[model samples]
Every structure is written in structure tokens, then in C-alpha cells.
Target: MCGIVGAIGSRNIVPVLTEGLKRLEYRGYDSCGVAVLKDGALQRARSTSRVAELQEQVQADGLGANLGIAHTRWATHGAPAVHNAHPHFSHGPGAEAPNTKPGHIALVHNGIIENHEELRAELQALGYLFLSQTDTEVIAHLVDHLYEGDLFAAVKAATLRLTGAYAIAVFCAHEPQRVVGARHGSPLVMGVGGVDAGERFLASDAMALAGVTDQIVYLEEGDVVDLQPGRHWIEQAQAGEGGAVAHVRISEAQRPVRTVTAHSGAVELGPYRHYMQKEIFEQPRAIADTLEGVEAITPTLFGTQAEQVFSQIDRVLILACGTSYYSGSTAKYWLESIAKIPCNVEIASEYRYRDSVPDARTLVVTISQSGETADTIAALKHARSLGMEHTLTICNVATSAMVRECKLAYVTRAGVEIGVASTKAFTTQLAGLFLLTLTLAKLRGHLNAEAEASYLKQLRHLPAALQAVLALEPQVVAWAEAFARKDNALFLGRGLHYPIGLEGALKLKEISYIHAEAYPAGELKHGPLALVTAEMPVVVVAPNDVLLEKLKSNMQEVKARGGELYVCADGDTHIHAEPGIHVIRMPEHYGALSPILHVVPLQLLAYHTACAKGTDVDKPRNLAKSVTVE
Candidate 1:
């Protein structure tokens, strides 16, 4: 995944493009570049550094243009060098070079082109030379060959020959007044900026449009957009009714552009050194916002139709990816134990590739923060195709595609999560899923009035409880000093807490770049115990549940092997800080909600460890904030 931004206006758009790229840097950070239509040609600057360096280059070169496109790349096709950065142009030192001026359609792209090899061969036959080893370069050359003095027509023709997920922004020196954008499986949004006769801005995320414009338009799949100074139009390829073999027809339409006043204030990094640290500390407010007006647990907490859907369903199927998948796995323990519903969790990317029996009575639940994850959306559609129509989602963005596609939704009010490793979003998702579990329990008659009230009381007290857990950050920073020196670590838990261990390990590996693994305590003696040594740090999640003594023995096995143990035990667990074992006592036993509290220290541990290791905690290497491409 990469980040793309384009703007067309009367003002010089170099600062606009650079600011948009700065906000979108979470999507990609390997390299960044900007191209502007200036002085009858395209002036471009590329850097193998961060967006800030690219901005400095733009200012130092004094590159100015009325319209431009910028990109921040997460290298998929080539190395992270200046030569491989975007925005890419079509001219190179070969037959493709017609001795023309610069800027023969400069383009910035987001997703992968699966058919680039075939397209490159065809373009080479036309005597077009390629400069960079990126699929986006092929697109620039193709658009250059097809241009008939109309930039939008040339872009539309080029996309018809391409296959795979992409969100691209194209600009031409010949048509410096306009910029064209197209999307297939990736995300792209349009915004209206400026005061009188506003400018048009396009980006991969709304956060990029913050403080510039609150009026936003989310593009749909297969939508091609043509943007000018104060106007825009859209075109879609309409297909005849023959399914995949249908004849395709082109149709153009224009709607009154609706503007949504986005909450841009959430994007600010207030009083924190890094966005990851700020989000980790914002957990109390995040959880409080998610459970603000909940007085009781009922099926209606999800939606009005939730009761009807739950009554007809006997099994639950959860589809998700990455951190969301681990949240779904945690919900499995609660869904089955409390709700008495048989539940299964599937990795969204793998679920659609295999043949499996689907039941009509199964409730399919999709979990995502952006709600634009391509694999999860495809998996949800596949389940629907197999006769499972009852669908729901626990998503953070209310306007995201997953929320629109599902029949019912629970939008988590975690605000905007910008860090690559999710913090507030994950905990808010657990809170939402816990609410789902309680609702299903009540519907199945598994939870009586007294039991429901008790769970509600615990739910209402979660914000304060999370606040107390955050006070343990100083001690977690102490443990992180030891972890910062280790090359590898093991995370251990059992029962409901095993999924929490998995999540903890994921956070550590994602942000800190540490090699980490998680195993159920019972599985330690089987194979993983051999990797235990004095240099290997073992992090344990031991809540005061039924598995406390069992987890203690697992801790003993690691200590016997000369491994340093870091435990986040409950207050009553009796685990003390010793010579070989380090303990951070939790405030209280959280019962079924222990995973929510136990994960806070793990996040702090990763953040502080990455800080000590001198790693980028906000944007880790080779990782993007959203997996928009499969």
C-alpha cells in the first residue's frame, strides 16, 4: 500500500500536496516524491527518506504548480531508493524518449498491478522505455501512448487494459488545468477546499484532507474521476446482465456532491512525543466514548433487527485480518462460553480460497477499523454468496465500506487511529465485541437478569479501570529497558487470555521490530520451551482466573530454563517482583474483561521498547496502516 494526493487550484499546491503527504505518511514511509506541472513542464523531486525530507526538497528546489500529484511509497516492485519513488513519468533514455519536454503524464499510484508484466511487454513493443521497476511506471507510459489531447479519456482507456487493485492520480503538462483519478479495489476520496470557488483535493484517507476541507466524497469501486479547479465529474463502467461474461458499457453520471463535516481534531498529536504514545494514553477516553450511553445490554445494542437475526442464528462466523482477527479470536471465547453459540474465526484472506460448508443460520461478523480492508470485504461477500445473508460488523469508521455492506453495524467511537500498530482501536473493538457477546447471551437465555446486570456494572467501570492500568506505564517502561536488549521474546497465556497474548506479541513485533511468538501455556513443554534462554524475555498474562496456577507452573518452566520472566499479574495473584521474575501487578481482576486491561501494558511495553531501540514506532518498516490491496 502507498499514499497518494492530488490537487488542482489557483494557489500554489506544493504546500497542500506536502501537508497531505505528511498526514498520509502512515500508509507508506519507505520513499516519497512529488510532481508539479510548472513552467510548461513537470518539475519533480523524489527522496528515499520520509515525507519531511521530500517537503524540504520541494521547498529547496522552489517547485511551484497550479496542479500536482504526490506519492509516498511502500516499495513493492523495487528497492527503496530515489529512483523507485513516485510520481513517475513515461519518458526515459530509449526509443520511448521522443525528445519532447518533461511530464508526459506523471502518475502516483497506491495498489499493485497484477498484469504489469504483459503490459510492459506490449509497451516495449511500442518502443517505450521504462525508468523505474514499478507497475505505476507502466501506467504512465500507457496513458502517454493513448493521449489524444484529452487527459481523462486517455486515463480511462489505459485503465480498461489493466487488471488488479489500484488507486491512481494522473496529471499531464499538456492539460495542466486538470487531474484524473481512478480506483478499482483500493480507496480514494475527493475533498473540496478553499473559501470562494474551492479547489479539488484527492487522497487515500480523509485525515490528509484535515484542516483543508471538511467536505468529503468517498469514491466507489470502478469509479473514474476528473477534477478541475472548482468542478469534478465521475464515470463508471456499467456491465450488461451476463455476470462475469457480460458485455461492458460505459456510463457517465454526476450527483450533487455531499459534504460530511469530518472530525479533523482527532488527527492532532496533542502533548505526546509520538502518535503511538498518544493513542496508548488515550485508551480511557476511547473506551468511555465507545460505551457512553449504555445503560443495559440488549440485542438492540447492535441494531433494531439484531433480535430477529440472533433468534434465527445458531452459529457465529468471524472474518478479519491482523489485529482485528485477534480481537475476533478473543470474542470466540466469550461468544461460546457466555452466549452458548458455536463460533469460528477465519483469517479473511484465506477464507475465500478454500471450500467450506456454510450454514444459512450462521451469523457472519466482520471486524475492521477502516472497514476498507479488501480481503475482509471479499470474505464477507463470499459468505453472502454461500447463502449466509445475515451479516454484521464492528467497525470504527461509520462511513467505511464494510459498514455500508453489512446488514447491521456497531461503529466504535475510537476516533482516528493513525499509528500503524493499532492501540485505541483494538481495545474499543474488544469493548464492542463484548457488548455483542452479552447481547447474544441474553437472547439465548444463557444470561439471566442478575448476570446481565453484573456484566453491565463491569462494563460501566471499564474507563476508570483502564485509567488505573495506564498508571502502571512507569513500571512497564522499566520492563521495556530489559526487553530492548533482547532479540526475541515469548508471550504466554491460557484460556481467554491466550488471544490477548497473541495480540501482545503482534503489537511488540509490529512496532518494535522484535521477533516474538505466543503460545498457550499448555503448549510450552511440547516444543517452544527449547528456545527459552537467559537472553530471551518471556512476557506472561496471568489474570486471577481459573488458569492462574496452571500459568504459574508454565512460568516456572521458563525460570528453570534461565529465562527472564515479565508478568502482568492481577492484584490477588500473589506474583511478586523477584530476582529472575519481574511483576507488574494489575489493579484488579477484570473477569471476562481482563483482556482489555492486560493488553494496555503490552502496548506500553512495545512503545517504550521501540523508543529505547531507536525504531520508528508510528510507521514500522514494510508495513502500511491499512491493507487496501490483497
Candidate 2:
């Protein structure tokens, strides 16, 4: 998914828009651009590098615009290039342009406009000219030809021609004092306050407008807003009747820009010698940051509407893609067993396409680090369409479209996760999901005071315990030297630990490009036993629990096959290591919750092994940050 931001105020807007884009870069960062209405004319610039390049260019000149919009483009219809970037204009299409001898418009969009090709062919048939090979270019053309001095109406009319998801921001040369914004399946929000000169801002998330204005409100799907310096109004009419037109007042607490601390800690090869080793050391604080404000959650946390939705929901459908999907799978089992409710876990990519069994009583919970994951967003929309009106999300990106579309939201404060293979995100999602389970149990009166108190106590101790486990990363790195040259590996676990084995295998595959497979310990004999050999490394997730002895038996099976065993066991005594078996005795045995601790070593092993292979850990091959496009 892409990120978009717009601002109209007496203050210079180009700098504001660019800064906002930086704050929202985590949404998607393939390319970036900015379009500003300045001096009664439209000025635009775009680039295909990290946002830093665009920021460098913007700073080359005095950055200033009373009204402007910016975008961080994630490739959709075209490849990642300057031409494919957003802020597309209507220069050629018999449409008004910057050279239209009068006026032009620049538009930046986040979601895909499904009807772009058809719209482009229609415009071409109408003798309209075209510029870049982008779906967004159609909007610039439509806005220009359709504009009759009313920008909002032109946007409203233009949106009618498009299908699929979108959150678009538009600016026109003739209206330097104004801006227009609209959204459909995609998410958008506008921060509505300022201290000096009443400088209001529009951003994809509260992060972009953070420090500038914490008082922000979101624009719901199918909602549109018109902007003016210090004030704005809603576009009372929409092309579609599905989304409502309403005014929501936002307060300062709803948004906060974290004080970006400049860290001098450039990773080095001293002693422990890897970013993964260093990052592993950072897990304690990471868990704590994610736990911030978690206790405030109650049945009434989000208001009466959320309470009503929670009360009425008979079951849950946890939808996600990738690691978040794995988190959902774990939550599904937890919700059913602990919360005593039924749940269906679906990979978001397949959710909307399948003949989903959904209804009004189902609450669809979409999980994603960046809320822009395309399939997840699409699934959320699909569920809402089928009358599953209650939607909630546990996401890292609070400003992400996923959070904006849903009625309730829970944010994981993992901060900037630069690695392509998620580490902290997985654990934080577990934390959030556990809380969600507790919330449901509390609401249904399934959890008594003693149970709730015990769980919360365990939850509170997570950060500290996570700290102790993270300190073991140095020891894990010592084990990774063996993984560097391995061709295939088998991961073994049981019970809740089984899903964790799946996640560990996934993390290794995602970043390291390793051929790894996971099997439930019992199922190891069923089929995967054929693959275990002297050369194949078997990673046994032997957390101390009810299944520990059964897992030990599986490890013994691997040893019989002469397979090299790397046991991530809870304690040394329980591991029963032979001459060939190596063990990493965990700092603590957290019982059923041990998977949360055991998963750490696997993440470190993946990261270090990938680093040893010289792979790009932050941007793995063919993998974009978020899968906004299918």
C-alpha cells in the first residue's frame, strides 16, 4: 500500500508535505513525489529512490506552498520508476495541464483505481492525451476536463468513473487556497487543528502530522473533504451511496509524533558482530513500547459503538497476510480454547476471493504491521460488504488504511522495523492478540477476576522476561555458523509450539532464502521423516510443557536418523543432548507461553545466516514492504 498526505495553510506547505511523507514512509517507500499549489500555479516533482532523495531535491530550493500533497508510491500498474510515481498530471489528454495556457492539477493516490485501463481507453478514444503509464494519471485528466471551478464536485464526479480501492488527494493551479481529498476502500485521514495561523494538515496517518498537530480525525471510506487555509468542509454528496458523510472531531491524544531520537549506534562488528545480535538486545524495550497503554483497553475502550459490536459478535474471523497471518493462526487457537469462542483464520490474500462463510455476527480482525497490505484491506472491505459490519485491526501502522477503515483499532508500537523478515512484529502481534483474547473473555464473563489478574500479571512480566531471552542472542549467533551452508532444515514443535515452528521456518525462508520446513513433532513420522538425514539440520523447538517429552522423543528420532539436531530447549537438563546434539538452554521456561520466548533464537538465526550470505536483510529480493497490490 502507498501513503498520501496533503496540507493547506498560511504556512509553507511543500516542506510540511515532504516532512509528512517522511513520517509516513513506513507505509510504502518504493518512490515518492509532491505536488504543491504555489503562486496561483501548480508545481510538481517526483523521484524513484528512498524519500531522502526527494527530500534532498525539495530542500535544494526554498520549499514553500500554502497547499500541497505528497505521496510515497508502492508500485501498482507500473514498475518502480520516476514515471510510475504518483502526483500524475493531465498534461496531454485534451485535458488542462500546467501548460494549459491557464491551469492544471496534480493528484496523488494511495489505493489502486481498478477502472484505470478502461478509463484510459475511454479517454484515449475521446482524443485525450496521456503521459506516464499509471492509473493515477487518469484522475488528473478526469479532474481537469470535469472541473468547472468547483474542485470538490469535479473529484466527486471523477471518482464515479473509477472502481476498486483508493484514497486520493488533489490540488489545482486555479485554486491555490484549496485542496480536495476522497477515499473509497483505501484509508485517509485529516488532522484538523494548529497552534499558529491555524495550520491544519491531511495525512495518511497521525504520524505524518505528529509534532505538528496531534488533534487529528480520519476520513472514512467514500468520504470526501474540501480544504481551505485554517478551515474546511465536507463534500456532502458522494458518487456512491454506501459511505456516509459525517463530521468527526479529533482530539490531541488521538495522534502523537514520537520524538525521533537520533541514535549514534551505527552497528559494528565488535565482539557479537551483527545488527541482529544488537537488535536482539533491543527486544525488551521493544516489547515494553508495544505494551504501552494496553491496560486502558476495556469493553468501553473505543466507545459505545465498539462495545455494542463486541457484545453482539458471536465469533471472530482473524484475517492477515504473512507473519501477521501466523500471528492470527495462533490467536485463532487461543480464542477458541481460552476465550471459548469460535474463530476462522484466513490468509488475507485468499479471503476476499473465496466464497467466505461470513455474517453479521462475525467480527473480522485484520492484522498487519503496515495496515496497507492489499489483500488484508480487500478482505476487510469484502467482509464489510457482506454485512459483517464489525471490523477491528491489530496493526503496527496506526495511520494505515486498515485502521482507518475498521471501526476499532489496536496499534503495536514496534517503532520502525527495517528488516524485511519481521522479528519484533511477531511478538508484539502475539501480545496484542493475547490482549484481544482477554478482552473478549472479559466481555463474555468467561474470565473471572483471578484469571484476568493472573494473565495481566504474565503480560506485564513479558517485557522483562523478553529482555532476559534477548541476551541469549550472542549465544544464538554462535550457532548460526552451522546454518550458513545448510541447504535444507527441518523445524519440529508440538501444540502451540507448532505454529511457532511454522513462523520460525517462515522467518528463515523470508530473509535468508533458506529451504526450511516445519512439522508438528507427531507428524514428523507421518511424512517429513523421509527428508531427515545426517546432513539435514533438525531444529527442535523443545519448550518445557505438556508436550516436552513427546518433542524429546521426536528429537531422539532425528538423532537415530543421524540428523544434526539444534535444540532450542527450555533448559539444559530437559534437552538430554548427545555428542551430536547442540543445545541453547533458554533463560526461562514460560510454560505454554514459552513459544514466545523460543521464537527469538530462530529469528536471530535467520537474520545472522542471511547476513552471512550477504543478502539484503532490510529489502529481500522480490519482496516489497507491504503487499498493497495483489
Candidate 3:
């Protein structure tokens, strides 16, 4: 995943481009660069560090222009290096000579170019020298080769030869007043701003355009956009006889401009030390917002056509990745048990490649925090191709591609989650999924009036319940102090809380860099028990449920092996603090909703552990907030 931002404005656009990159840095931060058209040539600055370093480089060099394109890379095709940084330059034909500067075209791209090798060979044969080790360099050269005095036409023609997902923004040194952008699979949004101030912008996410503009146009697949001072137009690629992009025509389809509130205030760390901690603490508000105004359970809560779609489908198929997958796994338990519906959860990346039985009557549900996860989006498209047209998305961003692609959507009001390690987004997704479960159960006549009323009351009390759970952070911090010394951890849970254990393990590994794994308590003897020792720290999600007795036996197994146990147990569980067992009592027992409350302590544990380890809790290492590429 990478971030792309481009601007064509009256004033100096260097600050605008740099500011935009700062907002999108969570999407990528490996390396950053900017290229601006100035003095009838391209002026460029690149850094192997974060966007801040690139901004400093730009300032030191005194580089500024009215039109520019910038990128923060996630390093897919090449290592994180200045040479591999974006704003890649194409020196044009016969530019193999040394000391060629400002050659012709400068481009910033997001997504993989599958046919790059063949295109590189062809371009090199035509005397076009590539200066970098990026597939994006080939695209720059291709555009240079196809330049027929029109940058838009060149980009359109370049896409015809490309065979992969990409969202590209290109600017020609000769055509210094405009920037042309096109997206095939990756995301690109057009910001229509500066009508009075005379500016136009393009970015990978609308959050990047916050404060600068609220008028946003989400670009569709195969849509090519031309942005210039105060004006823009869009064109869609027309498929030829072979289903390849033959030509481009003026877009007749509607791409509405929607007003999205600025998220600049939400991303601020405020009093919290890190975004992860802030988000972890924000779970109460996030869950409340997600369930807000839900006075009753109705299929229309998801969408206007949700009742029709839900009635037609007999089963539920969930596609997601990482933490979202865990949320889906938890929902599978709820959907099957409470809704009386068969549910299957599939890892989005794996599901896209494997062929399986697809039922037309099955409702395909996709879960994502950013809603721009490349693999999940591809999997959704794959499911649609198999004739499962009934699609729904549980996502945070209403403007995300997943929401646009799906027929029905329940947009979780989780706000902007800036941390690379997810917290509030995961909880909000669970809230949304639980609501979906209730809606389906009501439609199936499995939920009576009393049961519905009880569920609704529980849903309304989630905010207060989460607030109580968050107060256990102090106890979790003490556990983190002990856990910070351990190199590995084992987590155990049963039934629905098993997925919570998986999420807990994921969080520890993701931010704290601890090698952690989770298994059902019963499965410990099957294999994971062999790893337990005096130094091993086993964390258990021991809620006071039917499985509590079975989980206690598993704790005894760990204790017999001299393993230290860190347990997050319910208040009434009677699992007290023993010599080797440290129990952090939960404030209350929240039946089917216990997983939601149980996860907070794990999040706090991960946050404090990562803080103790002195790791980057907000950004983490080798990970981005959104997975925009496969």
C-alpha cells in the first residue's frame, strides 16, 4: 500500500502536497518524494525516510511549484530507498545520456504492475532508460512514450498496456499546468476545491483532503480524471472486443460530489501518548456511535433493500482479513446460534485465489476498517463474479470503495482510526456485526419481543459497560510490566471468545513485536501445551460462562507445567490471584457481548506492553494502516 497526492493550484502547491502526505502517512511511511513542474522542467525531492524528512528536503532545496504530485511509498516492488521512492521520472526517448534532469514525465503510483517486466524490456528496447527499480518507473516511461501533446490521452493510452491494479497521477514537464490521474483497481479521489482560491487536488483518501476541501468525488474503476486550476473532467475506459480497454470516452455515469466533514481534529493524539492508546480508550464512544439511534432491529438498518436481500439468502458468507476476520469469526458464532443461520467466515486473501462452491442464495458480507483493503475488495469482486450478487459491507468509512461496491452497507461511525494497530475500529465492527445478527434473528422469527427488548437494552448499555471495562487499564498495565520481558505469549479462549483471543494475540504481535499465538483452551493439550514452561506467559480470556470450568482445567494444565498465567476473568468467576496466576477481574459479565468487553483489557495490555518495549505503538514496524495493495 502507498499514498498518492497531486495538486494543480494558483498558489505554491508544495505545502499542500506535503500536508496531504502527512495525513496519508498512516497508509504508507517507508519513503516519500515529491515532483513539481517549475521553470518548464520537473523539480524533484525524494527521501528514504518518512514524509517529514522529504518536507525538510523540499524546504532546504527551496522547491515549489503551482502543480505537483507526491507519494509516500509502502515498498512493494523495491526496497525502501531514495531510488525506489515515488515521483519517479521518465527521461523520455534517447535520454540514456548521463546528467539528464527533468526529462519529461513525473508520476506517483499506488498498486502493483503485473506486466512490468515485459513493458520494461520493450521500453528499454525503444531506448527509454529506467532510473529506478520500481514498476512505477515503467509506467512513467510508458506515458512518456505515448505522449502525443496531451497528458490525459497519454495516461489513458498507457493504461491500455498495463495489466494490474493501479491508481496513478502523472504530470508532464511540458504540460506544467495540469495533472492527469487514472485508477483501475486502487483508490483515487478527486478534491474539487479552490474555485474561488483557484486550486484542484487528487488524493488516495478523502482524509488527505480534509480542511483543504470537503467536496469529494470518488473515482470509479477505469475512470481517468484531468485536474487543472479550478476545473476538472472525467472519462471512463471503454472495453473492446476482447474486454480490454480499447479507448476512453467522456464519462456518462454519475460521480456525485459529497460533503465529508474534515477529520483533522479526530486524528489528533490529544492527551493520549499514542493513537493506539487514544483509540483503545475511544472504544466506548466508537461503539456507542456505531449503535446510535437503533431503537429497534430492522433489516433496513443495514440498507433500504436489506430486508429483500436478507429474506432471499439462506446463509451468510463473511470475507475479511486480519482483525476484521476475527470480528467476522465472532459474528459467525452469533449469526449461527442467535440468528439460526449457517455462517462461514473466509480469509479474504485466500478466498480470492481458491475456487469453492458458491451459492446464489448466500449473502456475502465483507468487513474492513478502512474499507480500502485491496485483498478484501478483490475477494468481494470474486464472490460477485460467482453470481452471489447480494453483497453487504460492515466498514467504517462511508466513502470507501467497499461501501461503494457493495449493494448494502452498514457504515460504522468509528471515525478516523490513525493507528496502524486497530482498536476502536475492531470494536465498532463487532458492534455492527452484532446488530446484523439481531436483525437477521428477528427476520427469521427466532427473536421474540422480550428477547428483542433485552438485546436492545444490552446494546444501549454497551457504552457504559465499555467505560467500566476501560477502567481495568491500570491492572492491565501491571501485567504489561511483566509481559514486556517475555519474548513470546500464548492466549487461550473458548467459544466466541476464541476469536477475541486471536485478536489479542494479533495486537501483541503487531505492535509489541512479541511472538504470540492463540488457541482454544481444549486444543492446548493437542499441541500448544508442549511450549508451556516456567518462563511462558499464558493469557486467558476466562469469562464466567459454561466454558469457564473447561478453561479452568486448561489453566491448571499450564500451572502444572510451571507456566505463569495472566488471566482477564469476570468478577463473579472466583478465579482469584494465586502464586503463579495473576487475575485482572472484569467489572461485569456481559453474556453474548462479553467478547466486546473482554477485548479492551487485551488492547490495553498490548498498548502498555508496546510502550514498555519502547516500540512505535502508533505506526508499528513494516505495517500500514490500510492494505491497499496485494
Off by over 4 Å in 1: 92-103, 241-256, 263-268
Global lDDT scores for all candidate models: 0.88, 0.76, 0.91
User: What digit string (tens of lDDT, one per residue) describes model 2 on residues 29-84?
Assistant: 67889877666766777898777789888777555677788998878778888878
Instruction: Name the lDDT value of residue 16 in candidate 3.
Output: 85
Encode model 1's per-residue lDDT on 1-630: one tens digit a residue: 588889999989889889888877766478999999888788899999878888888899999888999988888898988878999988733543445445478999988899999999998888778777888898998999899999988888888888988999998888878999998888888887654455998888777778788777788877788899778888766564673322133333343355665554237787888889999898899999999888998778788888898889999999999999999999999999999999999999999999999999999999999898989998999999999999999999887889878988999999878788999999999999999999898888889999989998998899999999999989999999889998899999999899889999999999889999999999999999999999999999999999999999999999999999999999999999898999999999989999999999999999999999999888888898888878
Instruction: Give the candidate order by descending lDDT.
Output: 3, 1, 2
**lDDT-best of 2 and 3:** 3
How many clashes in each candidate?
A: 0, 4, 0
Using TM-score as the measure, the top candidate is 3
User: Where in model 3 is the C-alpha error above 4 Å?
Assistant: 96-98, 195-197, 242-244, 251-253
Query: How many clashes would you count in candidate 2?
Result: 4
- State the lDDT of candidate 3 residue by residue for 1-630, as single tens digits: 589889998889899899989988776478898999888888899998877888899999999988999998988888888888998999766675567665688999999999999999999989888777899999999999999899989999899899999999999988878999999889999888753546788999988888788988888898999988867889888877877665555642488778887586237678999888888888889988898889999998999999999999999999999999999999999999999999999999999899799999999999999899999999999999999999999999998899999999999998888889889999999999999999999999999999999999998999999999888888889999999999999999999999999999999999999999999999999999999997889999999999999999999999999999999999999999989999999989999999999999999999999999999888888998899888
Question: What would you estimate as the lDDT of candidate 1?
Answer: 0.88
* Residue-level error in angstroms, candidate 2, position 441: 5.7
Note each model's CA RMSD in angstroms: 2.4, 5.1, 1.4
TM-score of 1: 0.95
How close is every model to the real structure, measured as TM-score?
0.95, 0.82, 0.98
Report the error of model 2 at residue 349, Å.
Answer: 3.1
Q: List the residue pairs that clash in candidate 3.
A: none
Q: How are the candidates ranked when ordered by TM-score, highest leading?
A: 3, 1, 2
Q: What's the lDDT of the predicted structure labeled candidate 2?
A: 0.76
